[model samples]
Target: VLKDDLVYVADLFIGIQIINVSDPNNPTEFLRFGTTGANPRDLCIYESLLYYSTWYGGISVVNISNTLNPVEICHIWLSDRIEGLFVSYPYLYAANLEYSVSVFNITNPSSTYKMTEFHESVLVFDVFVVSNNIYLAGYAHGLSIMTLDKGGDLQEISQHFFPNHHHSLVIDEPYAYVGDKYSGLHVYNINCVANQRISVSLLKAGGFLALAIVLIKLSLKLLPKILEKLSPYKRGYGL
Candidate 1:
């Protein structure tokens, strides 16, 4: 969490710490607050609250209104591991280690509900939401953009294959910084009319290439007969 001149970082078992960087050259640790999560995988800070998704520990919400002495407001146990987190208004998106991204309604922090789980049977590694659009990065499926319907079912809008496997992604407006386990980091310009045009062009190019290959094969098949007819030794042998 970035708060003006202070930077809050979580060191998993070591808990969360506040670092004072009023002067960038000389930084100092200001405060340290303990965490209840066994192994904090990832966390997100919205407003004055800090939410963490832990490995094999579930989710924990902390009140960081007072960073020096932060309070653990609540902890929800899912009995499974969580890798990524994104807090949007009244909801918390928990990217599970398995194949689902669990959605939790956090309107009433004290009484949170497990709303739904999406991308089931797919290796969903990370997820981020922009307005109503949710960007999911899967192990094999790469990056997929989706939105939830009225009944909370996922509807895929568009997708991009990240070569081998997509591990994570971070979006900033028109650009998305994606990470692949085999290919490293990549920058993709998404959510624009230009991208749609590129998609159409790629489709057209693929169709043309397929047609060219078919024509080449047909020419090759008739090449032997044409060669025999063109040559003066046409009836010399089985040619």
Candidate 2:
């Protein structure tokens, strides 16, 4: 559920269903559409586009700009079972159970294609990414915090194991909420202190660079005065 009084539900074996939840009691079925494959694992919406991770069907993109009628826009086939999806602008990430994680370049919606696919040892149940940081809810691997390297490859930072089967995760600033089949909604305060190390180092490096520039400028300014003071030495003054 997002801002536009709309509800997008990934209807497992059926497909993607859109409902207008403005009225909580009597929600209206706005529209229902099927994907290329039978199972619609996850739904992610960005602006006017709706991204659907259809298991074995790759990813299906629909133009939901018109809420009343969502038209199929594009499809990218991966042949692997896509368990979850996360849309971060120019990129659409798909979490696969068997083939692992797949990344798609969706900078141009019309020409969306698979950018890269990599397999990690962990069981990928769901994936969420904000900026360079990625969060994955693993069935056996528990909760994994991964980061997207500059080369767009996922690198695991840390992982925590809960006493339940982890299903999905949602992040809210300083805290992260995990959905587990055994434990229900598990709330854990995200330890961002470790994540901030890189940022802190970058800030320190920036400050050093600024200080160097300032010192260089001061030296340049004082050089003229020093030369003026030593001018007599150079010209054999008082000789």
Candidate lDDT scores, in order, read 0.63, 0.63
TM-score of each: 0.73, 0.75
Per-prediction RMSD in angstroms? 20.4, 21.9
65-143, model 2: which lDDT tens digit per residue? 8777788889887677787677776788777888377788898898898877767776677776755767777676666
User: Which residue pairs overlap in candidate 2's backbone?
Assistant: none
User: Which clashing pairs does model 1 show?
Assistant: none
lDDT of 1 by residue, 1-239 (tens): 45657766656667666789899899999988666757666667777777876777778888878766788878998777787677777778887867788888888776767888765546776777777878777776666677777886667677666444555555554655455555444456675623542121111113334434433443355445323322101000001
TM-score, prediction 1: 0.73
When summed lDDT is taken over every stretch of 10 residues in candidate 2, the lowest stretch is 230-239
State the RMSD for candidate 1. Answer: 20.4
**Highest TM-score scorer:** 2
